[model samples]
Target: MSDKSIRVAVNGYGVIGKRVADAVTRQDDMQLAGIADTSVDWRLRVANQRGYRVFAATPKAHTSMSKAGIVLSGNLDDLLDEADIVVDCTPKHVATGNVALFRKRGLRFIVQGGEPHALTEHSFVAESNFDSAVGRYETRIVSCNTTSIVRTLGALKRAGLLKKARGTLLRRATDPWESHQSGIMNTLVPEQSIPSHQGPDAQSVDPDFDVVTMAVKVPETLAHLHYWNVELSRAADREEVLAAFHSSTRIAMVRLDDGLTGINSVKELMADLKRPNDNLYEVALWEDLVTIQNNELFYAYMVDNQAIVIPETIDAIRALTGLSTDSQKSIAKTNAALGIGSALY
Candidate 1:
């Protein structure tokens, strides 16, 4: 192990876990420790193909792995005892139990978006609160929506332009596996009992951040879109917000000029890039238009805010854990390195 490297074990080897594992392996200061999951199909096969040590909770998964000529020990504790940090990507219901077990064994834990909506004690974004993550035993990354909204709000708050914020989320439904496994697919539900799970957690960082969310599920399995309403403390011109989005290194604000009417849907936009959350490109903010009833209040176009904010969640994990690096500079550098374009004021 490199002296500066931190060992990280990804607990659930699903879609998110696989992504997390891939990211961890690429970091110079981090090492791919291991992966744990009971699932015995392609996810496990992918992990094995990448040369990560795999731990199986169920005998069936292990037996399947053995049949495939993989040579990993089936002990879960072995992974827990060896790694310095663990990322829990299990579903919300199962996350706490698995995370608590790792904590009991004296391991630092990072909870994925499955984090409880009210858990404000954890830093919401890794990049935004990285310093807070250092030397901490545990931290939670707010859900993707929370992550995206926080970054946008964070910039506004810093600029002293934001007074209140509201959000409308239009979601999509792809397939049963994607929905049951990912949840909130093929369904548009107004804010019900669940509360904007990430919204409250976000406001804990900034009390002025007020958010309202409405979700709609479409037929395609593309990205989520947002329509935002903002009540600014000061009557700011639209150009200011537009400029901020243009200058944000971590955000991608696309200006849908009148001549640019062709890109109306998220599917077309996704096809244009041919990648999911391309370099924190999930978020796109359009120029805000003043309302006729109240010119001071304005509306803006927004895209998947979750993609831009996921790194902040990662940055928070590093900071709260006393991991090396400054949060803000780290995020800015990462964005630049990734060639992500954002407008920051």
Candidate 2:
């Protein structure tokens, strides 16, 4: 434990785990203490990496990584005992069991993007509920859709100008691999299955702020998109709410093409955009006209649903540990560059 570093261990080295680990290693205040995975091949690559200590009961991936000139040197228990913070990017059900184990060892945890239920007494979104998560040993980032939408909503609500909010989320099935087992590679599958937490995750952030969600999936595997409808509690113009979303540093509200017809269906929306390779990197936004029919109000924003959530995961980790986002942004940006499309696409 160097005076300048906060040792961190990333558990479950799968897709989200790898992303989280890469982000942690690049932070000046944090050190990647190593990782634990059931995969023999993965452990070797991690073990072989230079400047990092990797350990495993099996030597396959560790040997491969070492042969490729990597640095690894610690076992699983060593990681649990040594790190200042343990980030569990494991699957939701597995996470619930493991989180308690980490706590028994007196370690603080960042419960991955899944399993808000594991949060028990932990906080929800970083920007919205981090004030509650800080100083606590455990907290969960809401599901990716919740992370993206709630961050935007929290920013908008905090501006003190909104009345009420309503939205629908079109999410990719990729989000469930580490947690929900039934949702991968399916199309047009709609349900309010996010949060894994019973209620929409947004109200967990702000109780008075009402939000309803309709979620759907598709064959395309790029990213999730959200159709947002917001009504300010107090009487206010739509532009004022749009301005609030636009001015937000955390959320990016995009421009809709004039010739673009409203996409009432998820399949058409994905096809219309051609499902760009780097969909998650860009915040997808589109405009829709509000219709006042039957004495009811309607409004919506089309958004690249996954864009803001990952950043918020980083934000939550930073908040829990008091790390500066400015210092960490460069590395995250670099990872984004190298990562480009396939990883997130």
Candidate 3:
């Protein structure tokens, strides 16, 4: 760990951006340089009220934000000038346009999985590939579902048990806050493709594994649940499969027998625990439901789409700045800072 703190600025203040900013404040080794966003709404105002120095994402946004009576530190360029690294949480395809400026300033950066892996040339999952990102200019933190896949399956692979995996994801229809504006109700929309983007994206972080994923967008907006049927290298006992998942600190084993019957139930538990935003950072696996038949193991888990990648983004910051040389050490610090290690059930 570094004796000094690294500066981090968030370029977007929406769902993922706001969470990333709050997670940064919890870290002893990181300082929030500032936050930049295009909207002149309550979200940006909340960032300012929370004591984060806020910046307008564009000159037009600057003028509009200033006129809207929201206090501003400066524009986007000014915010980047004060930071060692910036985590781009802007919407998909939108952040790509901002890359030229980040590169011009010689700043190390991290972008959400909304952006392509080719954009950064390196992808990160704290436990799986922290060392690869060390002292690197930038990396992409894969999306929520992808992050969960990597962490869970990556755990099994490390234990020398994984052979091949297939999963189906039940994704929330939309973010809770945005449900009013858009979302399908009383219906289920499947991705219409086999081996969804998530499967390919996970392999970007570690290319050796064989994994395939399919997804459906559900009517609710609480979180995502994935059913996985994995073929182990050998016929392992149920305890052995649990042991593999236990190897990952970020995997929280929950029990269906405990009455945490669905994704909403697990999310409600997080709220009961008083987690900020009621965030469930770890992959909440159904411990009692993990089943084994011959050489195949089956289980299901919930992925908190909004909060899962926050810790990974934090770890990427430490790696890019060389703040810590060890991957486990970095993950431990992030987990501690974010209250991430405890099991909900």
Candidate 4:
């Protein structure tokens, strides 16, 4: 590895891509090499306005982007040439197709969790699998919901408190800005399957974890809420479980005084905090809602689908680059760099 900062490129400037690019710019040990996208939409313009070198996802998109009055720094080839690592946040299945391109360049890359686990060397959640991901060329940061589930369960597992876990995920229909996509308003669609893919996805991060997850898409766009029922191996008091979560740096405890009763309130809190892109990277745990009875724990937490994984992507960059092997150290550095800490009360 070079003594200089790692050059990181972000492909696909959608919701997650744009946030990753901004995060890369904030990191002390990483640089935003450039960003690539297929369209010349407002997102591309926003990237350009932020002074990032914008590259077309492909050579063919260059002509169309130029016609749309958007200038390009170079094509995808140029981005691969300059970046030490590429964070592919392209739509599902698109990053898989680009893997061969990165491999041909001898470049390390990170993919979002929307892609299947088979596409990457291993699935990653900085807090759960940071050590496993170190020095790995291909890493997939697990989905927002998966990250939330793993973090909560991982914490319980570490404390020898978890026996079996199950949850129902209330997912947002679409990203806040993606109004044109389906399921924007007046809907509560169940995922039509028992134990949605989230359970298996979480298992990919930690195969030993036994969890069953069901999901439903709601009309809100603020975030995804998870209601978890954790059966502990031994009897545990609410205070004991709360203390375990409190010990985790990635879990941000939200007290009632924080004025965060639900996802919208959490968004408002982020806005009030002046977070970049109103990002909420930590798993927002409702302090008041945490309950336990006869070794069974129940609680509700919110995951900002568009933001929670951003820090994990940064941690993956460090892991792939041999920057850090300690999950706590990497998480601390990433969190501090991104201004991710406890929520304002």
- Find the candidate with the highest TM-score and give its number: 3
Off by over 4 Å in 3: 1-3
Off by over 4 Å in 4: 1-3
Number of the top-ranking candidate, with lDDT as the measure: 3
Question: Which 10-residue window of candidate 4 scores lowest in summed lDDT?
Answer: 178-187
| Candidate 3 local Cα displacement, residue 324, angstroms | 0.9
As a TM-score, model 2 comes out at 0.72
The count of backbone overlaps in candidate 3 is 0
Reference-based TM-score of each model: 0.81, 0.72, 0.98, 0.97
- Residues 140-224 of candidate 3 have per-residue lDDT tens digits of 9999999999999999999899999999999998899999999998899999888789999999999987999999999999999
Q: Show how many residue pairs clash in every candidate, following the order shown.
A: 32, 22, 0, 0
How far does residue 139 in candidate 1 sit from its true spot (Å)?
0.8
Q: Is candidate 1 or candidate 4 better by TM-score?
A: 4
lDDT of 3: 0.92
> What TM-score would candidate 4 get against the native?
0.97
Local distance difference test, candidate 2 = 0.56
Q: Write the per-residue lDDT of candidate 4 for residues 1-345, one digit (tens) a residue.
A: 235889999999998999999988888888899999989788888778889999998878999998997879999999889999999999988999999999998899999998999888599988788998889888998999999889899999988898899999998888877757656566689998989999999999999998999999988778899999988999888888988898777799986665667788888888988999888889999989998887789999999999999998999999999888788888888988998775444
**Per-model C-alpha lDDT, please?**
0.61, 0.56, 0.92, 0.88
